[model samples]
Target: MIDISRTLNADTPTWPEDEPFSYDLTASIADTGSVNIGQFTTSCHTATHIDAPFHFNNSGLTVDQLPIDLYVGRVLVVDVTTKQRITPEDLALIDLQGVRRVILKTDTWPNGAPFPTEIPELDARLGSFFHEHGVELVGVDLPSVDPLDSKTLDTHHAFEANDIHILEGVTLDGVEAGLYHLSALPLKLEGADGSPVRAILQEI
Candidate 1:
């Protein structure tokens, strides 16, 4: 069986112009009579993470409010590398008959290198597609679905408008396009807009 899951760590790539990923061991067993501990700080958007509605809406549900079934489900892998900006028109080409969860692998997976502005982003119209098609969770290999400079965050607003779960910073390097059993769980961050997740896909 093939497994398609990203090993989420501090070294994972991040959004352009966002905080760089980092982790420091503040306490070690050899340093003193204490437990080894790591202290780190990063934007919630860093690494493979789940974006709760609170990220876009002022009073929307936070990470903890997410239902259990939101992150665990059957998923479809849709390849969209040909298009720089993923739009509804692009999605119209796919056969999403019974796809409940969808993961997108595009030119943005490796995400090239971080840039000052977002290059490849998903159009807001694609967000409506997810909402209308019964997609519960959406994952992409890119750091974000919105342009780094998108102040309006149309993609985000559109998804959150339908209470959708968005997963970003996914590394779909070796994942093939097909159906898989997906598991992408986020931290139970209290009242937070988003949280890092341990995402994996198992062959069924």
Candidate 2:
């Protein structure tokens, strides 16, 4: 199995406009001179993460409420990177016949962008298509599946309306576009909206 998700570290990339992700050891082995202990601070949505419905819906499900099975499944990798933004037009290019799990590779990654911007927003119509088709989850390389500039975020509402889980802030830059068993599990944080994950791709 190849671990595709980036490591959860202090240097992990964050949303361009949002605050940078950070972590620090409040108590370390060097400081205590006994055991290696430390405390950290960071946004749950940092690095490779799973977005709970609660991220969008005020009363939707939390990360703890997510089914474990949803994290592992036969996923379809849809390579639709022709457009700057992923819309219905771009998704229509793929053959989603019986695909259950879908991961859109927009080449979204953690790289040399001094300040991040919402350049890639998905189309509102495509959200309905995925939900109507019963897609268990959606993973993408961008900070979000929805457009970065979306205030109302019709795209997010569309997916959250159906309890769709999303895995965002991925770094699938070198992965080949194809089907694979995905095991990108989120942390078991109780009552949390999201959790950083060690998103991995296991070849079946």
Candidate 3:
């Protein structure tokens, strides 16, 4: 299995002004004379995470309410590295066939790099295009599908309109483009807008 999840630690870059990831040992093995107990605080969107519809839509489903099947299944890793903007036209030449999930390998966010100010743009129109091709989930190796400063998340809303779910911040560097079995289940946090995921891919 190829692990796509980003390591959650103090160095993991988060959205500017958002909560940074931090872990503290609440009970050390020496102090407790037993197992080490630790606690962490982080933004749900930090690292590799799945954004529930509730993240962009107040009336939409929360992380716990999302369908389990959407997070685990056959997925396609399409390499769209170097593209400034990803639109339906850009994906038109690719064969989606029976694909239900697609993770775009943008190679924009390097591992261990600081949070980026600019990233490739994901067009909202691809939402319907993917829907037409039977895609139910879309993943990206970036923080958000929309621009970081966006107040109106058009792509998020469009994806929701087409029944497509979002998975973000996956590390896809050096991973070739191909078919794989994905397992990126979210924590069942009721009423939460999003949840960090331990995303992984296995060769099919």
Which candidate number has the best lDDT? 3
Per-candidate TM-scores read: 0.86, 0.87, 0.97
Report how far residue 51 has shifted in candidate 2, in Å: 1.2
**Full candidate order by lDDT, most accurate first:** 3, 1, 2
Candidate lDDT scores, in order, read: 0.77, 0.76, 0.95
lDDT of 1 by residue, 105-195 (tens): 8855563344324457788777678878888778887767788777888888888776567988777776788888888888889999998
lDDT tens digits, residue span 42-117, model 3: 9999999999999888899998889999989999999999698999999999999999999999999987888999
lDDT for model 1 = 0.77
lDDT of 2 at 62: 88
Candidate 2 per-residue lDDT over residues 33-58, each given as its tens digit? 88876656677787778888887778
lDDT score for residue 54 of model 1: 88
lDDT-better candidate, 1 vs 3: 3
